[model samples]
Target: MTRPAATAFPTPDDLFENAPCGYLVLSEDGTIRMVNGTFCRWLSCARAELVGKRIAARLSVSSRIAYETHFMPLLRLGGASHEISFDFLDAGGGAFPASVSALFCPAGEQESSIRLTVFPAVQRRRYERGLLEAREASEVARHSELETGKLREQFVAVLGHDLRNPLAAVSAGIRALSREATTERGARVLVLMEGSVQRMFGLIENILDFARARLGGGIVLTQCITDQLPAILSQVVDELRATNPDRVIDASFDLRTPVECDPSRIAQLVSNLLGNAISHGAADRPVRLSAVSTASGDLTVIVTNEGPTIPPDAMDRLFEPFVRGASSGYSEGLGLGLHIASEIAKAHDAVLDVTSEDSVTSFRLRLSAVRAS
Candidate 1:
């Protein structure tokens, strides 16, 4: 039992014939000088047939153009080229993808050869193309979604605008009949009609405001210096009480300072809060509305009611558009009241906040002296 003697370094012929990847050595003018066995096997050709031929003849049409225009120029300038992808033609005229890397080798003072290695890249190229197609499709779908959203907002704006004229005529007819009614039953029926008209008008206003906020950036405010804010808020409460005769609302105001704000927007805000209270508050308990001006020159309005506590999850998105609380459902008008109120408060340079616990729910609006931008 003895060990064999160590072998010498592998000869050039042995190394070139058994190399893993297809290898070629070509003249600077693109004539093939030598090729490895792997290269001949890949193209199903004999060494004698390819040795004296132009290497570019083995490439497919587009690959031949790429090789002549880009790869050859880059190799001449840089002495090397890496990851040049091209399609190669086999003996049967079928095309396969290949990635080539080459280095310039100087054989003499006046002559050079290109030594190249080729790797099969058919599957990898297919995967890269698939990724590009997927990215393009995703971008197209995203653009279509944005366009659809804009169209929907525009349609809502137009619909709200067209509804106002007929609503105005309905109100005019109601007013005319109110003056002519003599019997008590006729007067009651007219009152109900007026209440319905007012409710419809409020719903339309909310829809228009929502459209403006989504399409035109946000709600706009017209600020004016006024001393009649208390009366305006009182009018909102009076209307809600008239419409909902079964509910009792206790409203109190303690303000002595002049306030600057968007009067109409503020009225809308209070009205929304009162409406929310009437819809959700305990029927037997009275809803409370309080407005006070602190000595620090801050105006605050609070609306409170006693009812089932809002779930923690529902409270988080209570002011988001189209997101309703557990108590709000299909009957509510698109769940935009609290959302619009919040936007109005923001336009007035104020904040709308809420708190609920122990069967009591309260929403508060705090307005400081700073004007909205």
Candidate 2:
């Protein structure tokens, strides 16, 4: 059987003696009927001295004006004044910020007097000022960041558009010479010219992709994570291996744990980590990868390699955009890897972690827990 609720304790007299805040009861005729210790301390007056005294006579002029003209009208009508702020006159006649509210108390068939609650507003004022300052600072920082990002984007756009013409002219000249000149040097020059043009185009595309990701729309999440991960990883590994034939990669995966996530973005994360390991790992050593189900039911994927130590300074900033990884051979495209990984992880509510030492450097992506069913 359920138990009945306990009886309510304490009378009004006891409440005045132990009120959490200042309380003062004034007679309708303006005499102080009763005052709690809290009110006595707030106004810097002793109970013996303040009892039976007139609140209007002792209160600060501004506080008295507000109380009598505005708050008293509301309180007499059986309504309350909500946190009307003013000041009180201390025993030494000093002013202090205060917030007060009052309500009419019932006496038999009629209202007896007003019960006033007072609170010191010093801490509250300070807190409000601090909050205002924090908001202003945040807005300024955001404005500065927006301005800087726009300027950088403009610079990239102008640079790419301006350089395209010069690259075109160079390619046209090399082509014309290869067709007319009968020398072997002409053929090799044409090949080198074509290679240089390709490299320029690749760099320009990377810059564009970076800007797009930064100012782009949200991740387009796919319903499939299980089937997409393995296929994407295999393709990325094959592409990287073909480009760097000297490096050997050993990749292992098991993504049976299904989850809702963006496949291309997830693929971006996988490719970035794997490519990072391939580039940093010793040429003869194997770049290792593993994907398994963690005890917490999330998918735990790790990419590791035996390589030179990552400096403490660089490790802290490794995932930041434009930061060069463990290997300095990276150009513009490579810097966006870890940065994109971070974006993808955040979109999936997953965690991207990195650890590095003398012989072992690893990056892991911790996915959300999948349902057993």
- TM-score, every prediction: 0.77, 0.50
Q: Which pairs of residues collide in candidate 1?
A: none
Model 2, span 1-373: residue lDDT tens: 1222333785766667656678888887668888887777766778877789887777688778987898778776756677888777878888777788787775877657777888889888789889999999999999999999988876876787678888888878767777785678767666766756754654554455466556565444564635456676777677666556678888887766554566666666777787677767776799887877544546778889897878889888887877776465644354766776777777778899888887888998887765334
Clashing pairs in 2: none
Pairing residues by index, what is the TM-score of model 1? 0.77
lDDT tens digits, residue span 161-232, model 1: 999999999999989998894699988888888888898888888888999999976898888766688899
Q: Which stretches of candidate 1 lie over 4 Å from their true place?
A: 1-55, 60-84, 92-94, 100-117, 182-185, 294-297, 309-316, 326-330, 356-360, 371-373
lDDT of all predictions, in order shown? 0.86, 0.73
How much lDDT does candidate 2 score?
A: 0.73
Model 2 poorest 10 in a row by lDDT? 1-10
